[model samples]
Target: MTGEDIYFAGVGDVHGEMYEMLGLLKKWESRLSFVLQVGDFEPHRHEADLQTMDAPGKYRKLGSFAHFYNGSAVFPYPVWFIGGNHEPYGFLDRIANNTEIATNCYYLGRVGTVELAGLKIVGLSGIYKEHLFEKRPPIEEIDRHSNADYIGFTENEVLQGLEFQRADILLLHEWPRGLMTPDNRLDVIDPEMVGNEYARMLVDSLKPRLVLCGHMHRYFCHQIVWPDDTITRVCCLAHTRSGSNAVEIFRLSGNRSIESLRSLDER
Candidate 1:
């Protein structure tokens, strides 16, 4: 654990499948120092009343992560994640700003940077919504409805993100725009389903060593060369709830910089 190399695991959307996710991680636990999920971690338990609320099916509250949140189950390794469109905002907001949900599990807020296992990790929860980003709305306004909160972010949150300069890894629920195929004629992702433009702008500015994201439910990887001649590895993982071998590993040098990237194919 005190060497020039550190090993960690990264995954895509959990969508409240904690047990299923943990089952897969079990094999890698001995080698991995920690685990990180991209989004849709669903860190709350639904009350009886909320479960019966008159909201639409999608708006209905579900507490899949409640077991972990309430100490019914414990994550064997250090677990970290951001919020997604499907999480319980009420519960997450209560413990905002990297609060520990369990002994080894923590929530990375709307926008934040943390040092873990000698690596700098930055996280931003939720995808970029046009109404919130351009209108500069407040979280208070979005809090009026349960679904609105899932859209995520206030003007302040975006502004706070601008302050983050560099990180060893950046985690977000959305993908950066303009990621293309090897031929570069068209986008590797859906044009209409592109992610945060501001996030892409930050990638240009911060130039982190690694950027991991979810929400697309598919896997893609690209090597981005920044203006400073530094390289950033961007990867989108498959939904861990269904995707086989959901965990991806990365190695870091003693200087706290990434040395190599590993994916399911490599295993």
Candidate 2:
């Protein structure tokens, strides 16, 4: 790691595609850094509001709702995740709102920080209320496992409270702006404009050198249009090509400059 503070590895939209994580882990796991999965762990079930019983007269609570490597492989570093619309609210939302569950692995609600390789990592689940429009469908209406639309934080709410400038990296579930695609499939019609509006807001204002996100599924990368002098690089990474076999390794250090920064953006 250069004078650059730390290194970050990220992935998004695993739609139950656990196999894709191995290739990346195989190559980069030995480095001194951290790993982050933005959201969409798949195989998730929302049992919170689904009091309705299944065939056997037993009510089905959310199942297949936890975040995993999917491939069931162990990552070399501490693996952390943000909330996706697919996570179990009975598990995640409760943890975010309840102070007691703050540190529990099962529920790493909204924003939490991890320090490694001399970097501070801050994270937020994808299913925040602001990302879900009010006129948009209810949480249960859109996805099966989540109880309500992300009724928790707005983009400003998240930005105002957090100490972004101090953190080395930020992990989120959706894109900020110019990053979202106009033709997302889940809408079934008009675009929902989720992260397109503000993921950019934090990146431009906070100026963290790196931001890792999911939700768009396609590959993406961008530099912060406006940034602080100390935080010179900005990147929006692309998702792995396929869940079974895809990976990207990113390197950073204080010595980082224009030459190597461009190299990281290559396909």
Instruction: Please provide, for model 2 over 7-55, each residue's C-alpha lDDT reduced to its tens digit, 9 standing for 90 to 100.
Output: 5566665544444554545555566365567765433433333332111
The TM-scores of all predictions, comma-separated, are: 0.85, 0.62
lDDT of each: 0.72, 0.49
Cα RMSD, model 2: 7.2
Q: What is candidate 2's local distance difference test score? A: 0.49
lDDT of candidate 1 over 174-254, digit per residue (tens): 888767654642444456446777778767767778888888787777789866687888887878856553567777657
Please count the clashing residue pairs in each candidate, in the order shown.
0, 15
Pairs of colliding residues, candidate 1: none
Off by over 4 Å in 1: 1-3, 48-64, 134-143, 182-193, 255-266
lDDT of 1: 0.72
